[model samples]
Target: PPLFRRYQVNVLVDHSESKGAPVVYEDHPTYNNLIGRIEHIAQMGALVTDFNLIKPGALHRANGGYLILDARQLLLQPYAWDGLKRALRSREVRIESLSQVLSLVSTVSLEPEPIPLDVKVVLIGERLLYYLLYQLDPDFGELFKVEADFNEEIPRTPENNLLYARLIGTIARKEGLRPFDRGAVARVIEHSARMADDAEKLSIHLLSTADLLREADYWAGVAGNGVVTADDVQRAIDAQIHRADRLRELVQEEIKRGTILIDTTGERVGQVNGLSVIQLGNFAFGRPNRITARVRLGKGEVVDIEREVELGGPIHSKGVLILSGFLGARYAAERPLSLSASLVFEQSYSGVEGDSASLAELCALLSSLAEVPIRQSLAVTGSVNQHGEVQAIGGVNEKIEGFFDVCKTRGLTGEQGVIIPATNVQHLMLRQDVIEAVKAGQFHIYPVQTVDQGIELLTGIPAGERDEEGNFPEGSINQLVEARLIELAEKQRAFAAPRKEAGGEEEEIKEEEGGDERTE
Candidate 1:
């Protein structure tokens, strides 16, 4: 009956066999797994337990060391977060049965003595979770105070490129893959920049980079090569696309089959091609949508059809509002905006998001107002501000490639191209085929800084600058738009004048009749 027994000591974690403090990563951090658990033996229809059955959890094993956990997984497990917090706050690990914690057991149970805890707990999760915990959980700030944020990418400078090449070499060696030659390393670095979506930065996503290396090694072996080459790396990349591009192929097929109405040639008034990216899991590709605008005389309202029907997101609505501001600030500054315009993405049934199509929408509206046809061969992507300055957007490369694939499918006209924000030119790490088409003058990528430049490029007419007299050039796109707006305003005034005159006549007649009645 003595408390100190010879057979009672349980060695849950043995550090005597190791050299340093233990670093434990609990992939599944359940409540029992995190704070230890007690086991019992059923003898003669009764449960008997002892200290020897007490098993240590991650916290117990990582005591006086470090414990790494996934924040999402830890939160997903019931009572796991509370137990971990209790251990951290009290500076000790306590073991208890789930039934006892829930008060479901009526029988007496053994409680293990609390173990002294001195360990660092690290949680790996998305930035959103960290912020959510900081805002929602009061104990989070006090417990996990230090935060280490790792950048998804690093600058692709000459020095960093060498370092990245070394990193690639290290990973290849660690993974026991074939050694990559200099060209292959260069290709990988370029691909990293592409993954980062910036030509000036390389992605630091190690898992993706490592996977690419492994796949490249497999390709090298298949090709009977001793070392991985640039071709092997490119093959690996192509294989990845081939595996995930089923949806993209189907979309392109739809476009080619005339099921989707995207024009690669000709000219149309008030219509332009707008590029959008569709992201499916790890794969993203671009598709072109036709944006069109119609204008009439009204009380200065620009209706976004997508927003009216609740198919557009807030950002898209904001972009449409910005277009109204731009129109008023530019064309209607000296007069009331008497034009009502409706903008829509033709054949779009799904919800639309992002402001990247703002520039395209504006161009279409301008074309409608000016009655100048926009070239259907050119696709557009970028966000435009009230000042008409083109702003950069994400997935620039995909947008361009998406349009290019569509154009190439229809047999590339030499006039086919894409208009993107000037700032987004730095993000153009396009596919080799697209690049080759550009180099061969079969396709084009136009980087525009302002709406005027883009409209001029699309319409093949001058986007006229205003003179000191506040008049646009006689035969320019701006002049035409201004003239049309003035005409609409004048017509609106003329239409309102008759009602005013009729009201004035009625009031005079009533006044005369009142005088006659007073005389009687």
Candidate 2:
């Protein structure tokens, strides 16, 4: 009768103060935090527990509604994933002590009855993690049946542009920032396209767009304007770049001071400027690398020094091999390829990747073979195939601006320009300064479809096509290169002829000696 009078009851889930179903987001989904835990209290130097010490977990609180979690965090916690899966499978939450679950300690503990679960669970993560779980975890598909995919960018159609402008207005209002004028909206849309790195698409990365809007608002306030103007947005964008470009500035400084030798004028045989993009976190910038080639007479072997030294990635090595294929197919189809050439990225101490520099390397090799000088003022970026077709590369905008910055520092002559794949023409979202310079005839951007077009642009010589009889035009770059290859092949044959005759004479002397031995 006394124990019955002192009985206690614990309320784990209380919704008396709420009107709707509860929704919970568990930031840290540990084992005990996912499934309810029976907590113990230490009394008089001894551990003690009771029914009143029971604590409700996220599952209990979110019962009858919804629960959200970060997939990465759930996987990182010990037993958290298993506990969530167990609850989902059984449609109920069970509370148990950690020691009880592991059988580490079995003195005594209360096991609360399971609570019925009616909540829907949602996990947010990258596509990579989702794919990993779908492949590795058999239960993942059963639990997460529906999927929603979000695009990083949307097509930059006129209708979409209007919708994007409306989205910008919504963000401004929600953030309590100054309203953007029509010109300001247009500028923001242009910036979105730049962020997407496609002139025909706009980035939908809401966080970045929101940040830009907030920064523009701050600049607008500083300018004492009630509404954000295009000038303010431009200032904001410039300020953002200025903040993240310390490394880029240091690289440019090295080039400006001549510490890193990059030629911006004149011409040199077997040398061309190549562009590469360096991405650091949210900032990406391009720099020009001096790619040079040297050739001599030998059994045809085109060597990539970077690959030999283990400083080149597989893709870069593949590009070098492709160069050899192009040369053999174009110049040595009827004869043996007799040229030995080596390509290197001068002053490149770090690892090199990507096939974007293949076009530049090929051009440099052609220059060395033909003894033609390529203009140092021009840089090239693109991937080339065995057929000599130039393919588009990533980061075209950054590559162009990179060379333009270097040339601007050294005084841009009318001859300074960059040759890009003609297909990449649709991706040009250049900076205003560079665009102005192009309009003023101080700088240029040339898009080419084939290696011939690129080579002809790099060197002021014609890239002569093969006639029906398979002869290149005289004095043309191709003619020079083919003639050089033919000469090397002839020299190789001449050297082999003398060795063959000497071997024949030795064999005759051996035969005479053997005949004398037979007579004896």
Which candidate leads in lDDT? 1
Off by over 4 Å in 2: 1-9, 15-22, 514-520
How well does each candidate superpose onto the true structure, as a TM-score? 0.96, 0.95
Identify the runs in model 1 with alpha carbons over 4 angstroms from their true place.
Answer: 1-8, 509-520
lDDT of 2 by residue, 1-520 (tens): 5265338667888899978988899999998888978777787999877787889999998999989999999999988998899889999888876677778986867877888889999999899999999999999999889998889999999999999999999999999999999999999999999999999999999999999999999999999999999999999999999999999999999999999889989899999999999998998999999999999988899999999999999999999999999999999998999989999999999999999999999999999999999999999999999999999999999999999999999898899999999999999999999999999999999999999999999998999998998888999999999999999999999999999999999999999999999999
Best by TM-score: 1
Prediction-by-prediction clash tally: 0, 0
User: What is the C-alpha local distance difference test score of candidate 2?
Assistant: 0.94
RMSD of each: 2.1, 2.2
